[model samples]
Target: MAYQQQQHYQTQQPMPTMGMQVGGGNRNAAGKPLDSNGKREWSHGLCGCFEECGTCCYACWCPCIVHGKNKQRINHLAAKGSPDPDGGACCSGSCWGHCLLTSFLGAGWILQCINRGETRGRYGIEGGGCGDCCTSLCCHSCDLVQVSREIELEEKSFGQRY
Candidate 1:
């Protein structure tokens, strides 16, 4: 019963990681560890980079998920108006939810590991659930803005070369 309540509190409470701090208090930028909706994925931030790629949607800062050639991982779905699948990037004409990291990391090593791309997708919209139904699993994730920026630079370089 206590465990159940702990979980309930966890769910309802604002969960934050080590480095992610928000307002003047001990909260995150949004006053909560998780996003407003408590759901985060590839594009994590004020918005998610999925179904579209403006800000957080389709954007990623987590490490690269290695996929074999011609590998079909996600059962890609087309939302409204997206684009083509260049690197099998969660294509719904846009970015599908990517395995992303939320803002809170437990240990210092965890933060280092994230910087080094050792662990990926431990937070945010986890596709893996409690083995039953998908109960909107929301957790503190990393701000992959740095990672997203890096991708943009690479793309720009690639374009210049091509």
Candidate 2:
């Protein structure tokens, strides 16, 4: 009796690559194309607070409120489908949290740094975590103003009034 040899075949799945393009070119979180270096620059500089006097004043006088609004706007932009029911309320829980942290622990810079990092990630801005923390710690109000301006500009580009 002759026995036939049997062979088992295995299929290899392709591994997912980093920065994979879905349609055409590499796009950031806001659906904008990346530069040749694969990163985007901030719409406004950190020291450009005076560019929007109202925003600067708002950020200076009521930073927590501005933080809340900026957080809400970033969340809305990231979600990109339904509008936030809170409508980016300035007195949201985040505002209270920031106020409490700043008033009590003097640690609001931690939260601000996190939000700054998030904003950078969402817009694909070029920066490092260290820089974000430093900016939030040293230039807190400026960072808030910059992030707010960036979000507002993004919203305007998308034809949405902030």
lDDT at residue 115 of model 1 (Cα atoms) = 30
lDDT of 1: 0.27
- In the range 1-162, model 1's lDDT, one tens digit per residue, is 455444444346667663453221111112224556564333233233242343233223322232110012111111211111454443322122122222333222222233323112322332332311111122112233323332332233323321
User: Among these predicted structures, which one has the highest lDDT?
Assistant: 2
Instruction: List candidate 1 segments past 4 Å from native.
Output: 1-53, 57-85, 91-142, 160-162
- Give the TM-score of each candidate: 0.23, 0.75
RMSD of each: 18.8, 5.7
Worst 10 residues of 2 by lDDT: 21-30
Q: What TM-score does model 2 achieve against the real structure? A: 0.75
Query: Which tens-of-lDDT digit does each residue in 1-162 have in candidate 2?
Result: 999999999999776343553322222324445577666777677899988898789888888998988888778767764334464888878899999999999888888999999988866688889999999999999999998877765555544444
Model 2, residue 89: displacement in angstroms? 0.5
**TM-score for predicted model 1 compared with the true structure:** 0.23
